[model samples]
Target chain A: MEEVKVYGAWGSPPSHRVEIALKLKGVKYEFIEEDLKNKSEELLKYNPVHKKIPVLVHNGRPIAESLVILEYIDEIWKQCPLLPTDPYDRAQTRFWAKFIAEKITPAVRDAMLIPGEDAEKKTEELIELLHILEKEIKEKKFVGGNRNKYMDIVSLYVIHWIPILQEYSSKHVLTREKFPGIYDWIDQVLLDCGDIMENLPDKNKMFDVLRVIFGPRNNYKPT
Target chain B: MEEVKVYGAWGSPPSHRVEIALKLKGVKYEFIEEDLKNKSEELLKYNPVHKKIPVLVHNGRPIAESLVILEYIDEIWKQCPLLPTDPYDRAQTRFWAKFIAEKITPAVRDAMLIPGEDAEKKTEELIELLHILEKEIKEKKFVGGNRNKYMDIVSLYVIHWIPILQEYSSKHVLTREKFPGIYDWIDQVLLDCGDIMENLPDKNKMFDVLRVIFGPRNNYKPT
Candidate 1:
């Protein structure tokens, strides 16, 4: 087996996605925590394009971007497959993953990061997006029906990050009554991937980090 | 073989990406051209989420998003593989594909669509982005090296659309002198995939569509 190492930041949902895939595949690897404020030279070297965290180094070769890394992990480790085997099903899985990345994650991030009126608007948009996702996941126990697939891993932003955002803003973005399917799916994913679930950053710590990142709401400007 | 169909617009680079994949794989499929002014009901039904083209319908099921459809095509028809067999190589291919979709496409689109000062800024940004891509592809004949793959398909915007933007704006965003590697790549990809090249929309038609979509430059507001 090739030596594997993960460079990630705590409270990063994308990084958590990589961790979930690694844990699900039962791949033993070293974890190098990146101080996002003062990023490590290794992280920069591994991912110069984005200069972001959650880079998986396999036998010294680094792969960046969480979704791309997840696909690589799935292809290399056949046991406990992350994606469906069927071509159409795999496409569907990829579609949902892309959807989460494009729609869900950004909206959640904006809702959490932006201040004042823009944050409120982003929160509304986030809820609307979650409503659409609720319909898609209504029939399945997980995002990939019964199994916790790539989409579920991508959806860690919703399951883990939303609560932190809610606490920070003192607003309710996700509730059991409003998004029953998403709520259930969250529980199912946590139950299915307990080992990874156990290691997620604390909600209070996440809120604190977000507050520091965004600073006071009055002076915040969308970048 | 499953019944295959493509719902796409003539001037859409993403739509063209799907068409290229199907053509490269030697798959026979029906083509339904969408009118952007008034999208067909079939397109709306097939891709309700984004209501965007192109949607690749296999048998009865529909797959939206060009990159996802390309992956489906590659998986179903293995003769002309769009992704690398090696996991690391596959990851790199995916990384470039994502890079094109996220960074390159949007920058190019904004450079074309936005008006006046914003467009100038976007054009500068686009040129910078192309410089980076030039470095990535400097050593390879194509994005996949030796063959047209997913990144090459994703790069259709840069190959086909950039020239039209240059013609309209007369700003020379992607010149041979500045982007020699990209120039070589554009020629190589067109040569490698001549059939698809032959079917690309005329330059004037694309400019007209851009004009209509973005409206007059004076009135254009970046969305």
Candidate 2:
């Protein structure tokens, strides 16, 4: 019997990424909800370097980082493949995934935390990034092709978390008209893919949690 | 006929990563050195998003970002596989590789750019990160098992570039005594692997170019 476990938080976008991937691959996994206010000892033990959530443990070994976990899941299960078979296509998918993870997500979060003119500047920067992504998605049905794949799975943060971020910040940059390509992708991944829709955390709960964490009164600085 | 072209710059550690991976795979390719000051139209055309070098053009399709390119090379060529065959081992390798690329490299660079008390603080932060890596490497002969592989290749930035950064900033943080495990692995990769040794950019040349770009007089902020 193969034992798989995910140590993650409910409101965390990265944690949701892990759950969605597992659900997509039809792999049975035990989800251990972690408290960001006071992280579990196992979370720290599994990921000593960063001490971040969404660490995937299979049998006994632990894998940290959502992107790394996604690849591991695809490799181990070898069914309902996330990544494309061709090397170039896989590279392109991985490229966009990395851009989404490293660039877009951070910019979105940064846009929220900052206030005033700087926030506007950051929002603009994010818009520029979204434009690049919009162009990429314009030519395809989804980032990962016909059906939701690795890139689409990686983009859950954009679909689910960005709205909460926008609501909190009150800077609506990701409007449907501005990013029609990405907007269509949003429907395809969230609505078309029942597996992903089933696995997502409640958005209002996420917004509420985020309010406590990054509310104007709190001097919240991301680590 | 498979045509592989690397658009890279000397003195750029990310660029070196692409070269090392290609050499390890015994993949024949042409190297196009880009002038970072005035980048070529081809480099911009190939990597429109970032407009950065170390873009791997395999059969006219370009892939930017060194880590992505390395994975592409490994997947396509498959000789003397850079990543391990076991799924868990591959995940561990990838986890560390991402840590190195995203966390370690940026910290190292940030440490160089900042000055005074901040630089010292950044240096300490970098040392803390190195300690984490040291613990991981203490048990291994190389990051990539017995032979120099993907993790080892990814760590070229730490082995080669940190020294330049330290020299430029005048902060000696990565001494052999401070990080013995990493030091030993560095020798194993640089000294033992003739391919890597032969392919390295001239260190002094790199120093000169970097000095022109980031010297004290120049208000050089990395984009």
Candidate 3:
């Protein structure tokens, strides 16, 4: 097998999704950590389009976009299939995955970048989107069920990114009752009934990044 | 073989995407057109989550989302391959397809939904996005390349939808100078040089729908 190299940030859901896929597939790859603020030339070279992490280089061919990377990994290794063998099921997975991917960055940007009523409005819309997400992902073990697939990768985006909203506004956009299925699903994916606190990345670190970037109430300092 | 049925909206790119996939595969299926304003119960029922069109119901199993439907169609009827056999290539195709899908909706929305500055902002962004799309899609036969794959299906979003942008805004986002590659590709897709154009629904009727819903814009005056 040719060498597989992944350029990524430590705590990004996109990066995490690729990491889990490679791990599940048992593909040996070297990881190069990137400072998003100061992007490395390798990251720039590999992913000039987005200039983001979660870029997968296999046999010197570069593929960006975490969702794209996951699909690529699934196809190459084929050890543990991330997508369903059946066409309909695979379509369902991709629909939900794309829906999830489309919502994530915008939701985060609204919370972290935008301001005023627009920010709050976008947050409300974002929460509504998450509810739709929770409703759609209520079935099976993982989003893909007993086996992890594209949906699970998308789930990481939600689980990991929402904290920034919290640190910035102290508003829990993802109220417990609102998204029980998804909240429960995350618990299942990260900490199964038999296992506790195993798969999820550190909560503190995620919050820390959010707090640093977004600040509290868009100003951070207490009046 | 179980029965195959598709519920979709006439002149919709998403709907046409699934249709193209079916046509390419030579799959036999019934097409049900739904009025977007007055959606059918069956359409709502088949896709309870999205309540949108381009739902493929195979033997009572319903799959929604045009991209998802394309994937489903390809999976079940493999005669005409919609995705590349190689994982990386497939991923690359999908990356652009997904990128195209995400941008087209918003870009069109930007051009049509608002007016003045907000609309202009969207148009500028849409132009930038179109340029990116043109550059990225420059390679291969289609987004799927050498053949119509899943990307080709999703690219219908562009074909069915882009004209609306042009018709309403009094400008073509994809012109020979700005998006020569995209202009050429769309021409190829719609001109019957490739098998893709044969299946496309009429673009004029789509303009009729937009006019009825949005009234007269910059140029075209609605009666």
Candidate 1, residues B89-180, lDDT tens digits: the string is: 78888888888888988887788656467767888888787877887787544334644477677777788887877666556678899889
Residue A216, model 2, lDDT: 42
**Local accuracy of candidate 2 as per-residue lDDT tens digits, A1-223:** 9999999988777888888889888989899998877999999998888899999999977889999899999998888899888887888888888898889988987787555568778878999999988987886443346443787787888988887677666677899988888888888777767767675777666656777777642433332
lDDT of 2 by residue, B1-223 (tens): 9999999987787898898888877888999999888999999888888999889998888999888898889899978898888887788888888888888888888787555568778778888998888888885443336443787788778887887677666677898988888888888778767667576766667666767767642433332
- Report clash pairs, candidate 1: none
For TM-score, the strongest prediction is 2
**TM-scores of chain A in all candidate models:** 0.87, 0.89, 0.82
Each prediction's DockQ against the real complex: 0.81, 0.84, 0.67
Top candidate by lDDT: 2
- Per-residue lDDT of model 3, residues A1-223, tens digit only: 6899999887677787888788778888899989989999989887766778889999998999887788788877878788877665677677677777766567756755565667778777777777666766675333345434566656666665675445446666776687788777777656632221245467666556756785536444332
Output the worst ten-in-a-row residue range by lDDT, candidate 1 chain A.
A214-223
- Output the lDDT of residue B60, model 2: 88
Question: Cα deviation of B57 in candidate 2 (Å)?
Answer: 0.9
Docking class of 1: high
Which stretches in model 2 have alpha-carbon errors above 4 Å?
A113-117, A139-148, A216-223, B113-117, B139-148, B216-223
Put the candidates in DockQ order, highest first.
2, 1, 3
Best first by TM-score, ranked? 2, 1, 3
Candidate 1 displacement at residue A109 in angstroms: 2.0
